[model samples]
Target: MSDLPILIAGGGIGGLATAIGLAQKGVASLVLEKASRLGEIGAGIQLGPNAFHAFDTLGVGDAARAMAVYIDSLRLMDALSGEEITRIPLDEGFRTRFGNPYAVVHRGDLHGVFLKACEAHPLVSLRTASEVLDYDQDGETVTATLASGERLRGRGLIGADGLWSNIRKRVVGDGAPRVSGHTTYRSVIPVEDMPEDLRWNAATLWAGPKCHIVHYPLSGWKLFNLVVTYHNDAPEPVAGMPVTHDEVRQGFEHVSPVARQVIERGQDWKLWVLCDRDPVMDWTDGRVALLGDAAHPMLQYFAQGACMAMEDAVCLSAELAGAGDDLEPALRRYAARRRLRTARVQLQSREIGQHIYHPAGAHAALRNAIMQAKSPEDWYDAVDWLYGSTGLEGAVSREARTLGPE
Candidate 1:
């Protein structure tokens, strides 16, 4: 086998998770980050049981669990009438049924779990300000060109670079990401700033007509992560741009006082014009492969962007470890295992935004009726394909994990 390390683009959660996952399997990896520092930008992200499965596989389960703020349920509310639509209880039963607990954590904390593990591991090397521009592969080895015109060689290349990936341009050749025309605003406030009556230990979503609001406790309940989105038909991509509270309130004026108050309490709100891509079959080329947002960017409706990326890392590291010198075939196997699953997520995220979250009048009524009729068991079964499946069987640790009520 060549002594060259596998090169990974980007240094976000997915990149670090892949680096650590590879190290756990005795494979070495070099993470090339475009930024001068390695960190996460978001506030909070929901973790399905599938994310926990991936965590264990990547050897960061315990660290991740320690930092997470486990919620009791996924509460869906009608923003118009301020009524309960339905809730999926993430209690003991849910954990036992899925072999892991659903929880919410600060994005930086979760990233730290993987980053710490990667830092401690001898097989992983981290580099900042090293942007991977494109690559050249000659069967046995792949050479990556950086933005500064420097070149690096590796046995294989995995593009974990996010949404605007430089590697994807060379690998998939698909045009720019499809803009969803949805503007999302996010903020984090002290727990005290949250409405006392609304302080529930759940991942709460107030779904309305062409808009929605989500709030959950993060960072050990020290902060509340508030994310609210509206279909304003934004024409271009935007990220982390500061917006006044009044601009955000314009979209939620119709929502009930209870549902709209989240936006009122928000401080220093930032905006993100959402975007995703139509799923494509090919994300791998020879010794190069794409992971995370680079391969399958999706709307945040399903809350599985980071989770899917970690899951990809699990399958990818497993394949690479097993394949030895055959990195091309290894990447092909990795893409085969992940393609359909990621595609399902990508498509369904858009569906959820339209059908469940943003419908109005008759559509909203139909959504509420159908969703309210489901029992916890039905909800569990509906998500079994995502949280429990054969896709992660051999990759995850079978050892049962136990957690106390939060």
Candidate 2:
């Protein structure tokens, strides 16, 4: 089995997590990254219970917890007035019920844990600066061409390359991803710089018409991560360009003063044109499968993009390892199990973005009413299913049998 390694494209969170999961399952694989170094650009993400459980399964949940800030509660407020409408406790009770706390961490820090795991494992090898150009799959082998003119042959190829996946082009025909008609501005600020009185150990969301802002501490309370998204007639910023302060302010002219304060704090920011694809029909073709953003690119609304990818890595690895000699069918069954769950996340992320972030007219009022009607715990219940999943038992029992002799 080692003769034909599993080739993973894109070494972001999903790819590395997949590698780690494969290692834990005794399935060896190689991860190919387009960047020269392994790093992620983004602020903190909320790891709901489901992701937290997967993190524990990957054996990094504790390390991640050490680096993350635990949200004691979640708050929903009037976007324009700053009046707290509802609050949900995310502390001991929340953890006890969900089996994991709502933890937040910078994207890079989380990625670091996964990278360390990969490097320490003797079974996992990583090739950086190796961009996948093309791939071909046969009955027993899959081959990928690198930009440097090198070739890698493996039993299966998994693409975790992210939203603009090159591998997706090979498997699914290219027509650009659908834009959500929303623009997101992200920035990280030192926690100390914010007003002391307002500093709270909570994940807070101020929702307004056509825009919303989420803020929480990251890196053990040293820094705060902030993301603001708004529906706009303004053209989405070009990908990979610096977003100026003026651009951010322009999006939230009519928002609350506190919202403006938060935006102003992030004078320098990066912007992304929020786009998502229809849930992919298939993540595997022969021995080649797609994982994470390559398979599904989610908006930040659910904060499940990384979590889903992490779960995907674990399931893929577990199935492959349990399959023992039958790697091909194992890969197929892995895809079937993961594809449905990820597709739901993909579609659900966009739905949250649409309904929660960019609500219009009466829809905005309904969003506000819902916030007023529910406590933070009520909101927690809404997201319970997502953060509560641990794929180990189900994937092992069902997929293992699916890959067994017919």
Candidate 3:
């Protein structure tokens, strides 16, 4: 094996997960985080069964499970009528069918799972406030130039730098990310503050015209993560901007009082104007490749962004392990395998937002009717391509099956 550690730009979940996957395959890695401290932001994220597959494969299954709040179902409500639309059970049948449980976790807790594993691995080294500005690679090695103008060389470089990735600017060169005209507000509040009548052990979504509300228990029922989004034609892209409760309430007035009450209870609300990009085929350039949002940023409607990124980590490690010292082709293969799967997610997320979550009148009726018709088995088959398998077939799946610390 090469003595040079793989240089990973960004110390977020994707980057750290990559370090763990690579370490399990007897590879060494150095994670570069632009942040002064390594941690995750945001309230909560939903994890599909596929995420569990990746977690188990990355050798953090038990640890990840320990931090997750396994919900009873994926419940949907009609915000217009305050009526139950449908629910896909996450009971024993769901777990048996998917080979893992559907769950939710605080983003920080999930990131901590990987951070702890990466910190403990002998093959993984972490750095903070060291951002990779760009890179230049020759036939044998890739050298990353940090923001401090220091150059570090490695056998390869992986960009998991997220939505505003410097590595992606050099690799894909697609320019700025597309700003979807939707605004989202997030808040985490104590469970007691959540309405007792509405509190349930489920990842619930209240869908109305041009808006939606999602909430679920987190941190062992100590907190509730509230995310409300409105399609109010927000012009520019914005992130983590603090907004008043009145601002968050602008477009949700039309929803049922039951659903509107969820938004009213939220505190310390932060706003994020949703953004995504049209999928591009190539994300690999020689020994430099992209992962996570850096590679394929998508809307949050599908709730698969992080899950897809972790899957990228699993596949990347497997491909690199299979290639031995030949790094370039391995990286290319990794991008190829991940492109279609992630792209499907990327495009579908936009569709889900437009047609499912934010539709009006007849459209809402159609969505409710179709979704209501789905049985547990029907829902299972609908997501078969995504959650039925880890979507990392052949080499990746084979590698995942051999997971263990080096």
State which candidate has the highest lDDT: 3
Query: Model 3, range 14-51, lDDT digits (tens) per residue?
Result: 99999999999999999999999999989899999999
Model-by-model lDDT, in order?
A: 0.90, 0.78, 0.91
| Model 3 TM-score, all chains together | 0.96
Clash number for every model? 0, 5, 0
lDDT per residue as tens, model 2, 1-406? 4566788999999999888888887778899999998889877788877877888888777777777777888777667777776778887878887888887888999999988888999979998999998898767778899999999898778988988888988877656677777778888898877766557788888778788888888887888888888777445434545778888877677777876688877746888778778876566666777888888777777788888888887778777886655667876777777776666677777777777666757887787787677755676666655566786543434434333211
Quote each prediction's TM-score: 0.96, 0.92, 0.96
Q: Residue 348 deviation, candidate 3, in Å?
A: 0.7
Query: Mind sharing the TM-score for model 1?
Result: 0.96
**For candidate 3, which ten residues in a row score worst on lDDT?**
397-406
lDDT of the structure predicted as candidate 2: 0.78
lDDT of 1 by residue, 1-406 (tens): 4688999999999899899989988899999999999999979999999999898888888899999999999999999999999988999999999999999999999989988999999999999999999999998999999999999999999999999999999998888999999999999999999999888999999999999999999999999999999999999999999999999997889999999889989999999999999988878999999999999999999999999999988888888886777888788878877887788789889999999889999999999999999999988877877888424542212311211110
Candidate 2 clash pair list: 49-387, 50-387, 50-388, 87-376, 88-376
Candidate 3 wrongly placed segments (more than 4 Å)? 394-406
